[model samples]
Target chain A: MSFINYAAREINVKIVYYGPGLCGKTTNLQYIYERSNPQQKGRLISLATETDRTLFFDFLPLDLGTVRGFKTRFHLYTVPGQVFYDASRKLILKGVDGVVFVADSQEARMDANVESLRNLEDNLRENGFELKAIPYVLQFNKRDLPTAVSVDEMYRLLNYKGEPTYEAIAPQGMGVFETLKAVAKQVLYELRRK
Target chain B: MDAGLVMYEEEFDRITSILNRLRVESSANIVFLVDKNGQQIAGAGEIDRVDTTSLASLTAGNVAATDGLAKLIGEKEFSILFHEGKKDNIHISIVGQRLILVVIFDERSSLGLVRLRVRKAAAEIERVLTQMEAKAKEVGAMEAASPFAEITDEDIDALFSE
Candidate 1:
């Protein structure tokens, strides 16, 4: 949900990074947390398990300067990607304004990627949002892996909506900001449309 | 998943006044209002020591988890939650299904007093929010004329130049 505070001249939008297990959702958030100026970001909170896997979700709030006299802030969140955490994933998508689907590009994880995407669609539907109508982007992550699938193959299978897609090596920070920038822009354009 | 929140200056002022009054009357250390979506709307009292943003987000998560548990047990919802600590206590209550009100208090106040004051405050807050929602719907038609309507792709690209 986007919260527009006329009194404070601020706009807050919630964006979620969603995908299957070990798909680099948290890596994308960590990259943004490290790169953002201290004054423009809040503490990155990770509720994870002992093995460093996300238990519930990861949250990072970023203040991305101003637009049209309103200070724009985006609360970035990543859902727990393991199959057992589907309940937690649904909760995290409760009030999202936009979404970034971080698909694991490795050929071995293709089925997991497709399952996760289907889960995303079902969860958004339950929350009264249609995936095709919402502001969304796709990130084919783990592009640096030797066994990764080609971008064309990944897009052919995952880009059902033909949304803007990026090739990402999230750990190396490549395409991290690009993915964020694309979704954030769509969110702003969505606001203007409303 | 859009919660569709729109706050105006006048509505915010009114909500804050009610919150401030509740804080004084209940003698709570901090009192704040947050949307069910985890966005902090307005707050009053001594909040400098607390990170209200994180508090709001975690509180929402707690409520959501509890709601799931409630369903598992054949209940529709649990509207209020209380957690007690040695030095402080946290009380959270839902307001009109869209917002949550939280009060953090120490030994200076009693739960009974805080609950009493919050009951009155939540009703007033709910009233104000209803009015705001109605006004927003009325103004929705004119939103196409917003200053942001003219934003271009170049404008978005400039945001990342730095």
Candidate 2:
């Protein structure tokens, strides 16, 4: 649902980062928080558990310049990646405009990635946002780690056909903005089509 | 128009500088200066994926309902609402006269920081808005008409046409 404010000619869009535990979902947000210009970004909120799994969510509000005369702001959020936090993840998915599935690239985490993807689909469906209907971008994170699966193999296992995908090392800031830019651009495109 | 409504370059910088200062001072996930309807006027932190449109509508509905309920109970309108969910917690504060400030956080953040930062930011935001309202008065009543008020049933129908 679009909430248009007459006061400020700005449109707000919500995008979520989701995946299995240790997929760098939170790290992706941290990197953006660190690198973005001060005036263009707002608070970076992170929620984690005893073992450091994202407990609730991580949130970041960004001002991505503007399109036409309307200001474009992207609200980035991340759901807890651990399996036990399934309910939390679903709640976070409510009213999402875009999704970034941050899959852990390690071969051992392949099953986790697949299951997490399924979880995302299930949650979106429950929220009345179909997986294919909403703009989604895939991100294979932890590319810097040893024993990481090849991008080709990761894609074969997790790809949603034709969806934009990116290879990233979030902690080091590789491909973070590229992925954000892609998803944000797609979100704006979807709005224009509206 | 009060000089307050129109933010100067220095005022903008002041808010930005406050963001960097409060990012470390508090562990808040997202701090927003929004309207009562949930339209964010300004904010600091990671808020990339949260839905403000739905949030604003929901908040407005919540405020209205609560206010109505309070009136029924012979009480005043509510000035705040806190929604605690499994994944995120929202603290909504009515600031200035018409603006709303929301602080969204998770388990990893602190309430104290959220409060302190909001305290400073809210005062500044209220000051600017007070100036804006005054300026708006000077702009004449023609521009004061709400776009929403002008939206007709036909416009609503068109919105749902697809």
* Alpha-carbon lDDT, every model: 0.90, 0.71
How many collisions per candidate? 1, 25
lDDT of 2 by residue, B1-162 (tens): 011122334444555555555555667677665554334556677756765544554454455456556667897767767788897788776777566777788888766666777677678766766655564456435452222334344433332232
- Sorted into a CAPRI-style docking class, model 1 comes out as medium
Write down the TM-score of every candidate: 0.97, 0.60
Candidate 1 structure quality by residue, lDDT tens digits, B8-120: 89999999999999999999989999987788899998888987778888888888888888888999889889999999999999998889999999999999999999999
Candidate 1 TM-score, C-alpha based:
0.97
Show model 2 residue runs off by greater than 4 Å.
Answer: B1-162
Which candidate number maximizes DockQ? 1
